[model samples]
Target chain A: MIRVDHLTKKFGSFTAAGDISLALARGESLALWGSNGAGKTTIIRCVLGLLSFEGTISVGGRDIARDGKRARSLIGYVPQELAFYDDLRVWEAVTLFARLKGVARVDLDATLDHVGIPDQGGKRIRELSGGMKQRLALAIALLGDPPLLVLDEVTASLDVCGRAELVALLGRLSGQGRSLLFASHRADEVTSLAQRVLMLEKGRVNAEVPVNQFVAKLGAGSVLHLHMPAPSRALAMELLRGHGFAPTLNGVGILVPVPATQKAVPLRLLAEARLSVDDFELLSPRDASLGQENHA
Target chain B: MSATALETREAVEAHAPGMISNVLTLAWRELRDALRARSFLLYSLAFLALGLGVSYVSAASTGSLGLSGFGRTTAGLINIVLLVVPLMALSTGAGAIAGDRERGMLLFLLAQPVSRLEVVLGKYLGLAGALVACITLGLGACSLVLALQGGATEPRTMLWLAGLSILLALSMLSVGVLVSALARRASVAVGTGVFLWLALVFVSDLGIMAGTLAMRLPVKSLFLATLCNPLQAFKMWALHSIDASIDVLGPAGLYAMDTYHDALPWMFGASLIGWIVVPLLLAVVVFSKRSPV
Candidate 1:
């Protein structure tokens, strides 16, 4: 649904997005994962025709630079910061955007309902919580039912439940044959929702991994640091292996590699063993890899 | 067969609205917001009170007033309008696009099918609508006061003044929108717009006057020099309204020329058109090329 070819953005001597090329197919959910200043926002802006850049960006077979208005009409953009008229009610905001998108007034309520904010028509923007505001922005983006949706850090401010809700909404959107390009710094958020992941570093597409493989490589293996009260390291190791953990006896503690999916199984096994566990911590492998990458 | 055909017709009948209607709807929303704003209402009220006071004082002081007396009264009112109306237009225009950018609402507006030209025109028209209402109320109140007194209040004069005010406001608004498009901050746009207005209205005239005096120019040349400023066009137009008996096409045509005659029409029209077109052209160029934040 979208093609970005060697897109590069420069400000004086600084390069924001450098020679990045990627494509997203219809109904595919791709997440742009990166650290801060990774140029994700810059790339999104270029695609939106907001910023001038070198190279080409095409949306739904139309070149954004050549036919910006027509291309934009086929794409829905949800910016990181959910900005709207604070005084406008939910319905007013949605209807305004619908009108701007050239949607008939009759379709506005249906669009609002589609975004899961059905009964919030009269709620003022200021009165809504951060999650609701984000939903309102999503509803605005979805006003014309565009084929492609671009979301930037949409789950940044949401609580766990809200993030789950948004993930479910994204899943449904992708199920409906709509392409989604989401950019976020939250690894877990992307891991749970994205089908494919694009990792960026220093304005470059450093890696592209399938979501399941990425989770397996980065999340499948985790470190379990356990301190036993009785200093029964050998017994703890045996108990850990019984629970499917690759355990190593180190001094008075046990270090184990636990598969992420079996995280609860090990904990349950430890509780069943009745071992006096002084302390335990689940160390995510992705966090460790990211730290090493940063150090390198 | 009939039911199948009915379903096909129903599907075909589902239509979306056109883009122009959408732009107008958005523009109407902006107009409503401006009208409901306390600052707009307060500014209009202040202008009305000041206009009434000036007209009342001018009418009371003059006795056995001839065409010259009427000319003076109208000139005073025109001066007030030219000075105050541009200031109002500048403030309103300065915030037009920059404010939206700051609040990030510009993204929401632009996300639609509206082109940059449509956005600029819609905003200009919306602000112009509010400006017209305010100018009408203020100018109409002054004209009413003058009529209540023994002064001659011509309908044509009112129409001309209103028309001139709109042109002037549009010009100032164009300049303001240009600044807004260029500046990253609303305050900077407002400051730059105000500075440009002062330079165009007062500073440029002062410079021209100094140059004329330095060259030891004739009285006629000095009078003609005033025409270089748009405010002077307004002043000349006001002068013609005061005394219609004066021969506007004679050698001393500065005072004699009809306010709407000959080159004056083209002069105001060009100035107004230039203000609307030039800045907007530049704005489109800059906005299209610049990256969205």
Candidate 2:
């Protein structure tokens, strides 16, 4: 479990994290959703007891300021960038972390196996691929079987394969009921790993919603765009309205916002009316941003 | 029950390792890095070569009948150690704490449960230990060769030079760590290290000359002024310990000899100790207070 209260961090004149408060219970996963300079890393730094900040932070019921070692003992941090001694072999790296964290009887091989890097123990960190290095970081964080994991932009720099490997590992972590507080700019990562999403903008919490509810909200406002023969457009709109759908004419097609409660209403209406369409496009909110990304 | 008592009780119940153990862990890591670095190997080889050359030249060039008190062999070796050992130690220490901070390794290390003070101590121990090991070994080799040369060897002088070299290295190392802590960038730390080496080794006399020009100084004051620079004090101690000439010191040469009575060696030793401690403690203070960024 982790607790942060009135945590405001400032670097000179600029405020990084402003009067933020949040709590995460054991077996829960919380994702911080923010873009660049959104103070995600600053918040994590404050929680790790690395920064001088206003207010208080506690991990596993121990105050960070008064009991840093004990609190850090409960935490396993995976930073965004690669952090390792390049010459150290996987076995040595893991064992070093184990000792630093004051773990007892560290099972280096078993720990690496848990993170899916069983065979990498013999190789130096310099020889590892980016994904392997990332896995190795995960392995290091997982040393001592820490109850909480604080990951910062962990999946941002990975390739597709690496991302999947990390995602799979996170899924396993979630399954094991370990608390996770990760900051990410990716939607899929939040959906896959976080049960609850905390939307952050300019160091302030905008919304905190369950992932399923957030997904439902995304679907509720999505427009189902379709075009029929111009002659039957009126008839099609009439049929759509009959299903309690408000359709707006956009260019040659009609856009309808489908609510999650009305499951299969669009298809049912289309099947019933038998309206042949020239084009159909379901424009979701995410797709709009994704399209802008590609265009940019 | 009082609140403070409860707090103390709870604190004791939490079995985090003490400061010494934490420092040991950090020192162990720093020592490993020092031993593994390519610069360490290069520095060791350079020392050995310098030693071999000096002692070889000493053995060949000496008179058939042993001449003088300290012999030419030690005088040459001391010259090498005085200049070279500080350079080696400064290079190591200059990068010690500050270089790691620049390379972002400090972020990783600081995220652990250890305190910043412990980090500083560990780094100092490791670096100081490393310089001692390499410099001593090189001096030992040089002394062995000088002894094998079979005539007019000054064992006491050799011992003094070896200890002085280690002390001088430590003094430079403290300067390096201090520069590292003060400078934000690694390039800046290294540049400052070079500037310090130049100022201490070549231009030290300039500072004393400027002071002498400003006001008249007694012979003792003049000698003390030169000793203010650690390298100068070390040089004076080395040459004077051989009971040789102070002629190379310019203008105040005979005055330095006249004024340098019994307390010269102790004063030199004190200056070296002061150089090592002052910069190092200042570094610790700065490092402990500042953020890793």
Chain A TM-scores, per candidate, are 0.85, 0.77
Give per-residue CA lDDT, model 2, range B1-293, as digits (tens): 33234344333223455778778877888888898899888988998998889877767677454534235777787778777887887778888877877777787777776777788889999988888888878878876776676656666767788888888888999999988888888888888898888888878778777777788776668877787889987887787777665666765667766666566678789999999999999999888667777
DockQ of 2: 0.35
Tens-digit per-residue lDDT, A1-296, candidate 2 = 77787889988989999998888988899998888888889999888888888987777766787777767777788888766678888888877777777765777778888888787889999999877787888887877777889998888888888898798888888778789999987777888999998878888887789988756754576767676778777888888898788886655666677775554577668777787777776677566445445555
Query: Where does candidate 1 stray beyond 4 Å?
Result: A107-109, A220-238, A241-256, A259-265, A271-296, B1-19, B62-72, B148-152, B214-228, B244-261
What proportion of true contacts does candidate 2 retain? 0.29
Error of 1 at B161 (Å): 1.0
Question: Which pairs, if any, clash in model 1?
Answer: A50-B292, A51-B291, B71-B242, B248-B256, B248-B257
Counting clashing residue pairs in each candidate, in order, gives: 5, 0
